[model samples]
Target: MSTRGNPWAVYRRLLSYARPHLGVYLLGVLGMMLYAATEAGLAGLVKFFARGTFLKHDPTVLWLIPVAVVGLFLLRGLGDFTSNYFPGWVGRRVIKQLRQEVFSHYLRLPTSFLDGQQSGHLLSKLTYNTEMVSAAATNASVSLIRDSLSVIVLLVYLFYLNWRLAFFCIAAAPPIGWLMQVANRSFRRYSTRIQNSMGDITRVAKEAIDAHRLIKIFNAEEHQSERFERVNEANRASNMKLVFASALSNPVVQLITSFALAGVLYVSERQVFAHRLPIDVFFGFFAAAMMVPPHLRRLVNISGPLQQGIAAGESVFEILDQAPENRGGGLPIERARGEIEFRNVCFDYAGGKGPVLQDLSFRVQAGETVAIVGRSGSGKTTLASLLPRFYDVSGGAVLLDGHDVREYRLEDLRAQVSLVSQEVVLFNDTIRNNIAFNAAGKTDAEILEAARAANVIEFVAQQPLGLASPLADRGQNLSGGQRQRISIARALLKDSPVLILDEATAALDNESERRVQQELALLMRGRTTLVIAHRLSTVENADRIIVLDRGRIVETGTHQQLLAADGLYAALHGMQFNA
Candidate 1:
C-alpha cells in the first residue's frame, strides 16, 4: 500500500505545491547556471594554460585568466550560496504551510475520516512526510537542474573540441546506463519499505509514550520494550536495505567513469602522437572528458532523492487537496437565545454497524435544564455531540435559535454553546492557562471569577502562584477531580447561552461533586443546558428529565413525574439509588 499511486500522477500532484514558490525556485536554478559556468570556465582555463608562451599565451590573455578565474569562483560561490539558501528557505516555508493546512484539514475532517486513523501516523505525515517533500522537491530539484545543465553545456563544448574523441566518451554511457537503472530499481524497492517502517516506528513511539503510566501500572515495561524493539528492528533493517542499495550508486558510477577515462586517455594520446591534435588541445580534451562522465554520474544520482521527494510530496499533497468541511455558509448570527431543537435527527457514527441516533426529536427552551439518562451505547454522548455540530446529523436537522446548525457560521454557533465532558484535556502550561483555555483574552479578575464559579479558585488561591501555578502535561500535576474542575472553569468563562455537561462530575468525590454541582447550578441559571448523567440523583432537580432507550426518546417529564411514572428513568434511579 505504500507505493500504490502512479509515479507520473504523484509528480503532477507535487508540482502543484511548487507553483507558489516558482519564482524563488527559478532564481535558484539561475544561480546553479552561474555555478555550472564556473566549472566549464575552469576547463577553458586548462586549454589556455596548455598554449605555449610565445603566440598562444598573450600577456593580456594570461593576465585576464587569473581575474576570470577569481570572478568565476566568486560568482560560483554566490550562485551556490543562493541556490542552496533559497530552496531551503522555500522548503521550510512550504513545510510550515503544509503543516498548518494538514492540521486544519484534520480538524474539519468528518469524524468518519478520522475514526480509524492513528495519531502517530498522522504525526508522521505532518513531520516526516512534510520534511521529505521539502528535501526532495526543493533541494533535489535544484541540484538536478543545476548539475544537469552543467552536463549538457560541458558535453556540447567537448563535442565541439573533438568529435572522434567525444564518440569514445559517449560509448562509455551504456555501462553507466545499466548501473543507474539497477540502482534506481533497487532504491525504489527499498525506499518504499523504509518509508513504511518509519511510519510504524513513529506510531510505536507515540503509543508507548502516551500510555507510559498504563505500562508501568501493569508492570509491562519489558513488554513495551519488546514491542518497541520489534518495530525498531524492522525500521533498522529497512534502512539498511535502502543504504545498501544507495551504496551501489556511487561505486557503479565511479567504475563506469574509470572505463570512460581510459577510453578518453587512449584516444587523446593517439591524437597527440599522430600530430593531428596539439598537446594543449589533447590535454584540454582529456580534462573536459574526465569532467563529463562524473557530471553525468551525478545527474543519475539525483534521481534517488527525486524519487523519495516525489513519494513524500504525494502524501503531503493528498492532505492539502482535501476539501474543508463547511465551505459554504450563511452570515454569522449576532446573538442566540439558546432555543435548541433536534427535529427527527438521525446520525451514524464512524464505523458504526448502524445508526446511533435515529429519528430523534427533542427541544430545550430558554432557561430550561434538561437531563438525559441512558444506558451505555444508547447514543447519550452522540446526541450531545450533535448540538455542537462536531459531527453533523446525517438526517433531519439540529436547530439553534430556529436555524439549522449547518446554516449558522460554525464559530458563531460554537460561541453560543460550551461543553465540559468527563475526559478533560489540559495543555502543558499554568493552571491559569488551563482555566482560560477557551477565553485566552480574559483578564486575571475574569479568570478568577470563572474559577470561583466552578469552585476551583479557592483551591487555586492556596498555591503560591495562584492562577500562575504551573500544571504538568495533561495536568498530571493536578488530581483528576482538579483537572475536571479546571475544564468546567474553562466552560464557565465562555459564559455561553447553551451548556452541555456530559458526566462532568463523574470523577469527583461526593464532597467535590456537591460543591461543583452547586457552582454548576449558578452557571446554569438563565441558560439552556443538557446534562448527561449516570448518577440519577445529580440531575434530580433538572426542570425536565428525559430517558433514552437505544436511539429514541422513550419518555420525557420532570424528575418527580418520571419517578412516579415508574418508567425507564425510575428504574435507573432505583438501580443507582440502591447501588
Candidate 2:
C-alpha cells in the first residue's frame, strides 16, 4: 500500500521500466567491470615495476613501464566512457517512459481524485519527481556496482600481496557499513521531506502566477511573496538536511579508512625493515590500500542519490497503482434515445461527507428540454453530472432508456451525452482544433458548419487567420463570449442525444447571449436537454421547469403553470425579474 517499508521493492519496480533496454544496461555493467579490473591491474603493475627496476634492475622493463602505463590508461578511459554514456542514455529513456505513463494515468483517473488534488502538485510529480528517479535507476546504480567491484578487486590484490595485512585493513568495514546504514535512514527521511516541500513550492507559485491579476488589483504582492518565501525556505531546509548527511558520511567513512591505512602501514614498515616482507610486496599492498579510500568514498556518496531516487520512485509508483476509473460494463449501445430517469438516487463525495444529493426521482422524455433551477448548493450541477457518470450515485440508480447508466459501457454512456459548463476550457490551439477536439477526421467543411452554428464564424471572420487563429493559454486571447462560443461549437460537433447546459450562456453579454441562444436553440432540437441556470430568464421557455430545494425536487410544471402556482419557481422568477 505504501512504499515506505521496502525501498528495494520500489527500486526494482522502477527498473522494470528499463528492462526493455536490457542490452544497454548490461553493456554499461560490463564497462564497470572493465574499469574495476583496470584499477586492480594497475596495482599489479606497481609490484612488477618495483621488482624489475629496483630489485632485478632489468633494462628491458624500463621501456615496458611507460608503454604499459599509456595502454592501461587508454583502456580505463574507454571503460569510463561506456559506463557513463550508456547508463545515461538508459536513464533519459526511463524518465520519458515514466513521465508518459504518469501523465496518461492522470487523464484516466476518477473525477473525484482530480477534484480533490492540486494540479501543481501533480505537475511537480510528473516533472520533478520522475527526474529524481533517473538518479536511482542509472547513476546511483552505476556508482554502486562500479565502486563496489573496485573495492573488492583492490582487496583481492591486497590479499595476494599479504593476506594478514589485507585482513587488518578491512577490519574497519563493519563499523563503516553501520555508519552507512544510519546515514541511509537519514537520507531517505530528508529526501521525502524535500520532495514534499518541492510540491508545496510548486503549488504556491502556481496559485500566485494564475492569480497575478487578482494580486495586482488587491496589491497583495508582499503577501504572495511572503507565502512563497516560506515554502521556498522549507524546501531549502529539507535539501540542506540531506546535504548535511551526505557531506558528513563521506568524511566519516574516509576517517575510518585512514585509521586502517595507518595501522596497515605501521605493520608493513616493521615487516619490511625486518626482511619479513619484500619491497615489491609492500609497494603493491600499499597501492591497493590507497585505492580503497576513493572507492569507499564513492560507495558512501552513492547512498544519498540512491535513497532520493527510491523516494521518488515510491511517489511515482503510488500514482500508477491507483485504481483507474471504473470502466466495467458489458452492455454497449451505439446511442441512447436521450430519455433520462433518476430513481430515488442519493450521492456523496469520496469521504462520505454527508450526502450532497438526497433521495430524488425525475424523468425527462426524449426530445424534451427540461430546465432545473435552484439556488447554489441545491445539487443542480451534481444532478447533471451523474447522467454521464462523473460520480456514481451512492444509493439507487440513474437510468437511460430503461437501463441503469452503469450497465452501459463507460465510453458508450459518455458518448451519448455532451456538456457545456459555466467554466469554459480551451486549449492553446486554433479555434478549429478546439471545436473538433478528440473528434478527429472531421472535415474542414464539418468544422466550419459547427463554428457557424455557434456564431463563432462572426468573430473568426475578423481575425487574420479566421478559424485557424491560435488562442493563448485557456483562450485568454479571446473575449469571454468568444470562448463560450468555442465551447458551444465543441458540444455542437459532438451532437450527443443528451445535452447538458450548465450556465453555458452565463459569460455572454446581452447581445452575444441572444445570438448564442439562437444557435443553442438549433442545437437543442431533437435532443433531451438539461439546462441549469441561475438567471431564470434563460429557462423561461423550457417545456418543463423543475425547481429544486436542497437536492429535492420541490415543484415542476411549464413556465405559465409554475408561475400560476406561486411557489418556489414564482419566487425565484420574481427575484430575478426584480434584480
Candidate 3:
C-alpha cells in the first residue's frame, strides 16, 4: 500500500509467475545471449576492417568480410525471433492461469467480504489490472534481460579495444541512475492514482448503465455524464503525468550521453594521431560508443513498465497472500435435520457497535414453519443471516442440528440452508443455467421441475428459445417479479433442508403476489421454513409467529394467539393491515 517505488521488489514477485514458463524464459535468455554475441562480433569486424588488423590480410580476408557480417545478422535475426515470440506466448499463458485462479478465489470468498465492494471494481481488478501482467511478462522482463546483457557484452568488447575510453563512458552511469530514481518515484505515485481512478471510473460507468431507466425517468443524464467525466479526467491526468515524467528522464540521459560520446571521440582521435594508440583501436572505440547509446537507451526505457509492473505485482500478491476465512473443526454432519438453535446470540453489524441481536435465544423444531414479523431495522435479517454464518456472531452460537454452524465447513453449512431474499440476483446466462447454478450434476428436466415449482416455467416457455433463452445482463430483461421468481426457482433447485424466505412477496403486485404466494406455500410445505414477511396476511396462517421488537423476541405464538395477546405482533399487524 505504500506509494514508494521498488522495481526490484516487483521483478522478484514476477519471478514467481515465470516458474510455469521457465522453459520458454530460458529459451529467451539463450536467444539474447546469441544476439549479444553476434553484436560483439560485428564490433570486432569493424575494428578488423579499419586498420587491416587481421593477422592474414589479403583479398580472401577482404571478400570474407561481407560473408561474416551477413552470417552475424542471420544468427541475430533468429535469436530476435525466439526472444520475442516465446515470452509473448508465456505471457498469455500466465494471464489465462491467473484469471482463472482469481475468479475461483472470488467464488470462495465469504459473503461479508462482498457486501461493501462494487461488482464493477472487482471486475476491473480481474480483467484490466491482471492484464497488465502481460506487458510485465513480455516487454518488461524480456527487454530487461536482453538489453542488460547486450550492454554488458558490448562494454566488455569496448574495454578490450580501449580501456581508458570504456572507463570514461562507464562514469556516466551514476548520473543516469539518479535520474531513473527520480522518474521511478514519480511513476509509482501516479501509477497508484491511475489504478484507483480506473476503479472509480468503472464504478461510475456501471452505475450509469445499471440504473439507466432511473436516470432517464429522473432526467439525470447530464449529471451522470459529468460524474463519469470527472473520474475519467482524473485517470487521464495520472497516466499523462507518468508519461511526461518518463519522457523527461530518457531525453535528458540521451543528451548527456551525446555530450559524453563527443568528448570520448575527441580524446581518442588525439591519442590515435600521436601514435599513442592504434588506428584500429580508435575505430573500435567509435563502434563501441555507438553500441552504448541504444543499449543504454533500452536500459533506461525499462523504467516505464518496471514501475507499472511492480505496482501490478504488489496488487496481485496482496490478493494471493490473503488468508481464507476460518471454519471451525468437527466431524462432518452427513445428514442435516431442520433443527436450528440460537444460544445467547449477540451480533454487531460493524463489529463494535451495539449488538443488533442481544441475548437472543430461539429454537425451531424440525419441520416447523416459523414466521418472524418485525419492523424495519429490528434486526430480523441479521438474525437470519447468522444461521449461514455470513458474519460470525460476536457473542454466542448459531447451531444447526445441535452442532455449531461454524463447526461445519462453509460449503456444508450453506448447502443445508437456502435463502431467497427480496433483493434477487441473476447472472447473464440462459434461464436454465441460472436455475442450475453451482448444481453441477443437475439435468434440464430437474431444472424445469424447480422452475415449475416456483411458478416460473410457463413464462420461460414463452421465450423464443424456451429455457435456453439468454437473460440480459443481471436479468434486466425480466420484470422485478420475474427476477424474484427465478431466484426462488434457483433456491428450490438447491433443495436445502432449511429454507429462509425473506420478504419474497414484499414488492410484488396483487396478481403476481397471489401466484407467487401460492407457489411459496407449496415450496415450504414439510420443510423447516423461517419466513420474514412485511405483509401480515402472507404469514397469517403460519404454524408459529415470532414478533421481534428492538432485537428482542416480544411475542411468540400462533398468529391468532399473538393477535389475542394484543402485543407487538398485534400492534404490527394492525399498523400494516388493520384486522
The numbered model that scores best in lDDT is 2
TM of each candidate vs. truth: 0.90, 0.98, 0.94
> What shift in Å separates residue 457 of candidate 3 from its native position after superposition?
2.3
Kindly list the per-residue Cα lDDT of model 3 for residues 217-251, writing each as its tens digit: 99999999999999999999999998888777778
Highest TM-score: give the candidate number.
Answer: 2
What overall lDDT goes with each candidate model? 0.80, 0.90, 0.81
- RMSD values, in order shown: 3.2, 1.3, 2.6
Backbone clash count for every predicted candidate, in the order shown: 0, 0, 0
Ranking by TM-score: 2, 3, 1
lDDT of 1 at 337: 93
List where candidate 2 sits over 4 angstroms from the true fold: 1-4
Q: Write the per-residue lDDT of candidate 1 for residues 414-533, one digit (tens) a residue.
A: 888989888888998888888888575789899888888777877788899988999877788787677878887888888899999899888888887887788778778878999999
Candidate 1, pairs of clashing residues = none
Q: What would you estimate as the lDDT of candidate 2? A: 0.90
